[model samples]
Target: MEMIIHLIFVFCYPANNRQKLLPKSPLGGCHSMKILAQVLSAALLLLLSTELLAGPLSEYRSPVAVVLAKDGHWLATANQTSGSVSLVDVASGQVTDELACGTHPSFLQKCLDGQHLVVTDTFGGKVRILEINDGKLLPKATIEVGFEPTGLAVSPDGQTAYVGLVATGEIAQLDLAAGKLVRKLEVGAWPRYLALSPDGSRLAVGCSGESRIAIVDVPTWEVAYTEKLSGGINIGHMQCSADGKYVYFPWMIYRSNPISRDNIRRGWVLGSRIGRVRLDDSEYREAITLDVPGTAVADPLGITMSGDEKRLIVAASGTHELLVYRRADLPWEGIGGPGDLIDPKLMRDPDLFGRIELGGRPMGIAMADDNRTVYVANYLKDNIQVVDIESREIVREIPLGPSISANQIRQGEAVFYDARHSLDQWYSCHSCHYNGGVNSKAMDTWNDGSALTMKTVLPLDNLSKTGPWTWHGWQVDLNDAMHKSFTTTMQGRRASEEEKEAILAYLNTDRFPPNPFRAKDGSLSAAAQRGKRVFESSDANCASCHSGDYFTDGKIHDVGLGADEDQYEGFNTPALVGIYRKVRFLHDARARNLEEVLTDFHSPEEVSGTRALTEEEISDLVSYLKSL
Candidate 1:
């Protein structure tokens, strides 16, 4: 930057401004100076381009979240891949400005102030508050919340906000007026989405990790009750009814049955659902399955209701479509037990619901002021689609930025999120490995040729660097492993050779997020330093197998964490990178956190039969482990 500035100054300006002396320009004359200035400008652009290109510039403006402004003039979108916030003009349909917020901005909402917007940097663990002025967005403040923050809910008055820390299992309460985090309220495992009642009396927390919703009383600032949703995972956006009577959300349920054609045909393998929790009574809840017999809905993510409360909308990202229903006609008494909640015949009733197809992977949905139009954040298409509810057709496709040609990585990413390739359109690879990371749930993938033997989903951080995949490390062929996952686990069609290559290309690009626990200078803390010593010591015997920059020797060991029904004898030595981002640990995911991993199942003493680690050593060791 300094060099560029110096070159620009010398080439674009006179050498002297004092003593009535005009020194020779770099190129001799004024006209020459202009040409030189042009050259310097091009060089500056190249430098800046080089920097941005070094990142994932090809995946520009992949909007994952969408929200309408208070007045509905501006529609703001959080583009996950490009790490930017794009504001589009509803009146002109032009993207006025795109502001770089942070790495992986996944969620955004209008604050109580009406002028400022709150955005969650999912991977950076920060909440960015930006003030809206005309068409430009100005950064007001950036507050550090917690690790892997995603979902967010702002108070009615806008003075307070709650951010869901996905990996940490807590909600960070922010004092927006003061621009800082006030406190963290523990909800449960994977508290990733939140919703506030209209009167601001209660907060509905979607704890996907435990498949429950915790309602926090506002006045007391504590969890009032927990509404359990059995067999529920992949909990999406939650919206409280205008009457504050119910909190509605969309999610998928895995029945945990064996992967067989019989199970898949019976809808016991996987199904999509939209459920609601009665706010007044915690015990009262209802859900309706969106899937039919042959044509099923997969990955129902975002949900919203019309202003008139006549229509309910859900974005099925996996299917790339919108499922709409007549709000008053919905089956609210649905109790999911013994194959009861799902009635494929209900889909035949035209008055009940309808599904409208949209291009690309639509994850987020926002309604216009008229309530008849919706703005969808299409992930694969790199555009925001405007759909008219009356016609059930797309009115327009608004691109936030210039579109680039699709490459193998992007195409494979599309495949990763697309559910159409799966049998009955049930799920995609992204359904399990969400955003190329673990979904924090262990399940039967049939990878080990075992039944009901659930295994934790491994993180794909530095995917290319970590080879010899799978828990047992029995699979040697990468392409074969992917083909098996698609065919056996998903019960989906086998991908062609070209498609498999593209999928591999996308996987190779998956890398771990920056470690927030480390110092800004990338130096380990004092506690981490001490923990590192203990980790490498002979007493711990950890570094012997878990060695290298990737933190794994690509070997398998028993570690006593394997199950009895396992097909393989020993489990693979997993990498330690980004271990802090995981809520569940161990091969079978028996341990809940790092603390449990250190003290219980795979403790230092248990693994190696050596000296037992002291309490202080465990604490420091856990701290150091989180720094990974």
Candidate 2:
């Protein structure tokens, strides 16, 4: 009977695309239905396998730097949102560890031993060291530093670590063995990345604020030489060739006021180039200026040279690709010549030689042991993309999440929504507002010739909960405000209805990140406590304008902060939830810091309409406002 049942089953099964006859059964055709179900299941499995192979390998959310260590066996990335570092094994393409750091880990550097990693928290104003043990990262120590510590460097001997204090324009040299500050070198304005010559005799520090490179004597730690560049050079990352004959610096025009619609035309107009300065002499020269075909500027970020010194790799941060140039092919006509003397026509075009779309903001880059593979950190994407130097193709991508997707509700969303335009090819809203709002610096002029003001531009996080937008309170709804600002005021291209909706969806659900302002027991700072008293006091009366959770009365009042008599009049009060992110204070952005905004209130130019408070009271108010 079993042999007969097997024969009947074989007869019912089809073969070679040939139809099979159903076997007669005492239980009717239930067996045939079961066979059909099995066939359907096999087909579904095949389709699923194809999709699984074809889907996006990984996604990054603001992945800023990428480095490979463990002899090219591991990949690490610094994620901006979760304030964590992700470690991935190259062989399996798996995330082995996700190590937490201070808030907003902007830059990462691996120690000489590859057993430790240091990350700079720009917003948190601290540096954290993590130890890698058995492929897992363990938090080692956290060191408090100056405000906005950005770029980082480890000495050639690995005895000293250099930390770039961006806001203060100083370099803090820490003794690695002792784990203490040995010296603080005041270099220049807005010092970014540090590069030491291969000989270890000189240190090349790029100052974005000064638009110059300060070459410091390694032993003496003094400014041995300074070479200036033309235009507003916001120098980012730098690398010295192993031969020590030349130093290559990558710089972009600094965008102090990134939000004004005019910023695109003005900021993008400046030319960008890789400057080559000889270490032997203080002569500065343009080695090569990378011009994108049709675009006015190129913002180069990470730069490195091949071990053989034959090829130079630059991560064009603005264009979202890696740019490579042959060292031999570069024309040497512009060395030690003036800016205009460098023939713009002879410059290498990044798109012509080699360009690969990594689909993220590429910041820091490092090469593998073979020098044939390059790793790029996609800052906003939250992952490291591994590129094959020979093919210029993305060989592998290591994810840095469970990342916050565009759909994820985060506090930055509201600020990003108010800052970004629908049709922009590069950058989002928060790219300019930074954490959420402005950076408090005056530029030549805004697109509309109106002075940029945080007191005017309202936050978007709780917009649905709050009504109206802008300092004038002109637009009633968030959607309308975005449309009008992007299209009309900023001159950003009009957004399609669908794109606008996607942007709005992203903005409406932004939730604030965990506040670093709170104490261990969730109490406010003592300064903030005193500040609150001053804020509610009759003399200050800050609550008269700013009130409620979003910290706005949603009303307009003239604070008088400009030379134009008409502008001296009233403006709508903006929300203060994330006001601390803004560097500049007031409508004109004249106040250099928060203290100036409250203390300088008595000046006719600043307090054209409002009365000034005493310095002590102003300090108290500032302390209180920061608590929020």
Candidate 3:
């Protein structure tokens, strides 16, 4: 029967045409029936082959965040890649419920009321509230928010919600009772997390792209201060001390500006560290270094302190470990000095308590009242690792759902996000191109085979279409480009041919997100419509270079913006589909904003031709460019 089934599937769905039978998730509607068929087929296949079952047992469906239920009897996980939330019984280590949520639920938080859970659907651009009853989750309501809602924080009173609009670079305040948007407050670039103080008077927004935290006064809804974290690139989960005296979070630390992969081998460039900021004074300091001299600790995602304030736990996503530090052992004083840069020896390190091997990337962490019990969302493994904090051991591994079957694209994604491929398990491709997006940093990659030359990191959206990769357009083949990246930028050994092929398959899956500038009716605005004319017109001549649907001629050209340290004369024209989310512009990150890209950097002849339009026309053109 198994042989006959295999023969039928292989003949009917043939390996070469198998992709057609598979569902195209991004295209949605038309592929629903096909998707269902594919799911059934996958289920049947899983049952037939016991060897293939291991994949579903230990792979990630992109678990984003984890939160414990009110009574501490259940754990809820926002599985982004799975587009659902898993509710697990704490005592039994069994998934009691798998509640379907909106598309790509990235953030999950338990409301102050204890009976409610707030989930942020990033791609769906909505916030979903679910009711918890007898350890099961039921959809309560959903409110549409801004584009790419990445963070969620319910007000202390549970009457209001502050959501971070990642693509729009603003925070939308939602009135839960009215089920309407109260207002929008502008903050830093790409705010990933919104952490409210214990007293609820202040809000700290972690701006990952800009490397700063914007502190907002809750009553006024205005940003009163901004704390700049030195030596950090991206900041993650944050929590305020119980007394509201300090805010603790994890951030990636770079040894110097314009980081190079060369430093990875020398053990100087990349590291992870916990940062502490005084709430009252806005004083920021690097509290403890997670990585040592030769080995890197990798991406530190979630962070939280124990109830007794004795232990500091960090979820090291890249390294797949839970890093614990004793509060008493940390050198609180004389930090940010020469003595702080030294690496701590794991066995003899005074501050280092223990490193618990999670065997999968951990995303979010929550501790119980006892402080000894901790719940961790093992992102890649699709399980909640119940950690005994005092013993520094994983006591239980609760399976959330059936393991997701891995394909070439999924395997490629695993390679992309896996830090083990890098030297000393430092960083992964995901660290720079976050979720196949931009990191908003300029780095001396030496991709053109020259030193001391810097280029702004570009977005990987629709990367396969924009090839001849790199600023200088050196490597035309996608596979070769990926292989070179692994060896040079990651400073790791060359990957096998199979691994290279998987990476290429993963790159082909990337697509641009929906533009937020469009009207609710899915029509272009008046400004954007006018700008579209300017873009395609002879006056602008923008269509000559940026011609195709992916928006690039696939050729290098010199618009006369080369710097002294540039390795190449002309840079590759980048795709502008998701340009609105970019924090910096130009090949070298010389322009800070979109306006400066056109005004100071872009040549007049390249943009306006002979016709110099009015300010309105320029504004319209800018609007249209962002809409693409």
Candidate 4:
């Protein structure tokens, strides 16, 4: 009876929010109302019981990565914003433990010995080691590494650990015994995540920055092979088949370049496809690509396999759910030719599981050895959700304490009111410059392949901190920047005076939250103190351009980092408040890190800017800027 009731409830509750209503009787109105009340009471009782049996999804915050551990006894998850990890008991459907880590732990992996757990902190640039004793987590160690350590992978022997440095485009190899860096290897641009083969002979590095995967030989630490991908293919996370014959990589492809006014107005389309590559073959061939339906953007982040490798678990971040695909049944070779790639018929319905809501941005997924349960990390909500894989139901939710939500974040308040302007429809200042700030990376143009500067299209985040906005630094004031966005970039009707006032109020409000690491006494760290001395010293003289509280002079100077056509002789110096968040540096987004930005030679015409600093000084300056 219990099993039947569970089945009936599961069938009635559609994965999407829509609830199916029973047909109304043609009886008298009072009788109909009585019947409706009875049905409502029954439904309410069922929901309450479900909550008692399986914890509500709302309890878990932003869960990004999920891992099944302890022979299905425990499930672990990573929460990005809350900076915590959670563990759930499978049998009782209850949260067993929730422990805090550093900042923004993106990935999780259980140690080979099953005694310790490892998590990578992308923003904090560190890896946390937690010991598991009787299903409880105890902090063991925190090892600092290169900039933006996004992805983490443990060797098959569990002797070595490889961390992908997203900002610096390098991989830091760690000696597990000493808990220190053994060496750093230069890989492709923007290396985010890694997948080790079943045999553990090779490691496939997913390079989102360069749109390729470089295979690194384990023993020799040499590049074994490189697989190039199509343009706009943002290769995120990947997984390997149990047999180790095939590799599946999920890519988030941007349909259009977001440069021109039309493209910006229309917004960008993001889609996901699963590309299968043979492990043994040197040549690249498409095995299969699945385009998920009903999702606006296919932002797939994590991929895993069932215990038997019969099903593939994909975490579609855009949709906030787990998509289980039947591997043997999926069409691999018969999609189409190169020109007509991807077949709609080949795509099938994925068994959707986990939270199906707006706030649950699922990032990583993993399965228990028995394949009976799955774990998912909610990135934004800061929690981990445990799901029964076989029953296709979320059974438990573990929460991370004291997390912020998008709605809770007050929008930047607008300051001006232009009666003549028309307001945009269904779009806010946070649309392009997400969270009131934009990525420094160059995006593709809409009409053609021409690249456009990111600064010109989106400039709301730090306008007060840096003046002379835009890539060319044409707009001198914030009002001008607002005008250009509405008239040219937004391509919407001008906003009314009242609407403009509201918009400006929202835009002007604090975009960045208070710095979590700001010193209470307003003093600098020892490293930052040395760095400040180097910055103002004549040897480095960075203060000549970057001066004042915001760390920017708000004036254009010849940095000598632009092309001949782009050579404006001078460009506006941007603020350094949150410099560590930006992966790319310089106006063109050419340099991968701050070291490169300060040291790279742009042109022979002006060498003074870059020539002023040594490599060590540049490192010090970067450290200080990150502290700011």
Candidate 5:
């Protein structure tokens, strides 16, 4: 059962609405010792009663993207888990249509004509075009693109479209009329968000895995400049300003290299921030912290500017609130250089004009033409929350469909995304393991009270198959790993035995996605075939360590990368499955790319038993490894 608090906020609302305060919860705020004592007592009683402990698990829809129709009469949202696009009537606040898009729809964009919609079928690896007439969506065509397409952007003339091939690290330009790919341009790792400038001269692409943004010259169809966003990871959502002067994006900012898990409580680890960068010179202009004096905002995802350009709204996913900031209240001129610390003191005293409560885990947000009404796709609620920006109140919660019963796996998934398990609702497991993958940040967990070695984030897929979890092989059992993670990483209490079991169950459900390198017949390429022979040959000696169906022998090897400061004996042999999606490699993330990992000292002869391989052999080997 998820802990849900539905309260009417009046902190920045009208004076007349201030009297409608809801009863405070026992475990509501951080400083209430009396409330914490009462909550603990209540929790003890609940645990004692079997009926109270075994409550029903709630189902979450996991909506990803939302957009307003060109005509502004209806709202469309892409429901990722449901594999459908929901349309709601703006005036009535009722779901008028639910159209089957495809498997795991990630993003939606209404065409300029207002009669057509383009949706990216992320897992299905296809772009679906649907025609909308009077609120009903009719399937038009489905164009197969590269693997795991997520972000979508239509050309200014509406004759072409560009999609971010997340797994392939490229952008596919599609001809709308022919319904085929015109060309594919290599960008960087995991291009998750694409935003075309207002003038359609530049396309701003946020490469989530690389922590960088590439500005593509639209006319040349080539990258003009790349901007490295310092101290930020998972740069997913981005919005270009009205004048195309800058791009505003919400990203989780790492204050410093996390030396210990204790840094979380001290507020020196992860913080939510809104970043602004100039497009002309490609400079990382500024990063403004979203935290106030006492409250720390976390997981700022969806960001948008109001129609009047006076207000900046950001959806704080971990906090479950919409942080509204007045443009005039922001200290734009006083912002420091790129190296300056993102101190909360540089911002306005109150920081936000209002913190309006929203539905569970809001991800994507879209404002109406008037900008007064905001449509938020609530990931955990399976609904769209219509919010009145002026009054800072939820106008309506438009349910997408009837809720269904969730099983143990779903329960575990809810727990994985629930921030309540973390102290002060700082973050959840999903924050670091975004989309069951890495956030592309090196963190020092201080697991053994040592901070010298920073560990790179790993993927969560095929968890049951890979044992001896963590880079250092700290915990062989998944249960112990979960317990230690909660107590140390999250700075929270240990979960119940049942909760741990449920989390493991959910983790076991994850399976590796299809390898895009394979042909239609599921056969490897010529290069991969050659590479497979080399991988299993005596010269490589890879099979001795990386074997079995899961690609690991369940062992740890020194291979001579461990430094003196490392507390552990050796590094765990990580699986090669889905290796193409990795942005960084090795335990300490010393090798930034696969090529570097293979060419580093003590890597070829020590890890693979030979260093005299030819360049072609190395290329083929990399190709085969990526195919896994």
Candidate 6:
């Protein structure tokens, strides 16, 4: 602050007055003084901008969710990394105000009243309701939902709100007027997105982890139907049709296969897609392979339709582009089997689909009333990109300030999320290790000698510490592991040495929030304490391989879980730090959940060659593991 004040004075002072502060040497001419003033002016402006962008919004702004004002005078963005919400004036393209939010602020929803703005603080597990008045936002109320509160949907009358709780697998219904939770409706795993129909009669919930969509009848507040998706993963933004006839969403598909270049090109290993389900009858369904033959789409995170209902827009975060599809030209059909899936080559039809390369990660989309103007939240760039739909070009970028210097960590983050470096812009490392964590699917990275042996995507939390890397315990070097991830897993060009270094620096910064499963003071519960005894006891023998402070011995163990075709004789011991967040368990993902692992496939006798855990013991052990 002192330095800033000093610089400001030097820059603001008249040249003659500043001469007193400069040296009396002959070099201190009027011309030199004028040049110094110009340099000081630029430096001061930059310093002020960077400093003001603080409060956790400096290097990585991460604007994942954005919303538009009803009158089209202003817009707002929910930044995840910065944990703040920014309101920008439409005409000026400058942030009017910024409010500090929570641990991770995600999806945003606006009410018909245009005064109430709802934001889900994802990791903080709270729904923040703010009132828009006098061109600024003021905290109106807060509703404590549950852990990992993500996507949000509000009623047409602005009286009610539905919040998706990712961890607990439930949708919290909040009475906005009362500022409290009314009740919670149980949904499938990872209910991270919610879409309210235009008529406000139905709520569509995207249960990404379970590969299904749950429809809730708003009048009765009950799940009317659950639509199962074909190989769906990372189901992101969903939008109901103007007539509420169908709900469309963008997601990725993964088929368990060898990580081969041919398979990737053929869209057999992993692919991007857009799915539609008929809400009018609750019987029909449609999905499209968004990936074309030569160029593939990745990480489609945001979706919105034009007011005229003529155009559909999707923001592909990984690919860093906007995918535009004419509503009339979409190859919509029911997905009944592998053959029923839409042909990827069909996307090649003229005027069927279009692309606008948005440089940074495009995470959220908001269409204006004019139908042709759209605002997109560019996560990596810390700005909102305005694009003209008719022109299919970026109109302008309204910066949200804090121009961070190019550091190695920031440089690596760009590489980590950049899909352009991948094969034809299909996917990045983050497509699997999502948000520096893990994706839901089991993928074959081909690190092991076996081709078809699949392994669950490991969490990058505390990655640098837990090594002897892959599931097969080969590739001890972290840099080599990263290199292989690109060349082998993504089938992309070999990553440069500098790229690997920056990525490692960024990966080391990945962290998990406080475990909601644990007590407030972070101590184990009574059940967990009892389970701790079982875990450490020789009878269960869990700590034999899963030992040490990081909860892994960093050694290979037989574990009795390897498949017959696996060339590797043993598997590396995985750490148990954040197992609560994992839905898929075991190296092959045979156990859908941790409970299934403890009771069915990975019983004490099955993994550790010890006595089987009784029912009470299993419950206690689950409690203990969740606390970690």
**Between candidates 1 and 4, the TM-score winner:** 1
List model 1 lDDT by residue over 378-410, tens digit each.
988899999987688899999877778888888
Encode model 3's per-residue lDDT on 342-449: one tens digit a residue: 344444864465788887678899988788888888776777888997787889888776666767777777788788898778888877777788776777665677
Cα error of candidate 6 at position 628, Å: 1.1
TM-score for each model: 0.90, 0.70, 0.87, 0.66, 0.86, 0.88
Q: Which rank order by lDDT, best down to worst? A: 1, 6, 3, 5, 2, 4
* Residue lDDT tens for model 6, 1-628: 3233344444444555566544354665676576666767776677668654333334466788888888898898998876777888899887766665666788887863777688997777788888777766667787888678989888878888898988778999898888899999888888999899988899999998888999998889788998987667889988998889899999888887787777777778778888888775677567777776677788898999998888899999988899888887776667453332336545556456788988888989999999888899998888899999778899999888667765787788889888877777778888888778777778877878777777888888899999988887886989888877888777789889899898888788744677877765788889999999988998778888889977899898886777788887888889999888888998988998777897778777787677888888888988899888
Question: What is the lDDT for 97 in model 4?
Answer: 56
Q: Per-residue lDDT tens digits of candidate 4, residues 294-359?
A: 222345667887778777777766555666666676665523422223345444343432223323
> How many residue pairs clash in all the candidates, one count each?
0, 18, 2, 36, 0, 0
Q: Candidate 2, which segments miss by more than 4 Å at Cα?
A: 1-62, 121-126, 146-149, 165-171, 179-235, 241-251, 254-300, 327-353, 379-382, 399-431, 439-468, 488-492, 505-528, 562-569, 576-580, 599-628
On residues 277-304, what C-alpha lDDT tens digit does candidate 5 reach at each position?
Answer: 6766666457666664335666778888
TM-score of 4: 0.66
State each model's CA lDDT, in order: 0.81, 0.62, 0.74, 0.59, 0.73, 0.81
The global Cα lDDT (0 to 1) of model 2 is 0.62
Q: Model 4 residue 489 lDDT?
A: 48
lDDT value for candidate 6? 0.81
Candidate 4 lowest-lDDT run of ten: 411-420
Candidate 3: what lDDT? 0.74
- Best by the TM-score measure: 1
Error of 6 at 113 (Å): 2.6
- Steric clash count of candidate 6: 0
Compared to the true structure, candidate 6 yields what TM-score? 0.88
- Output the lDDT of residue 208, model 3: 84
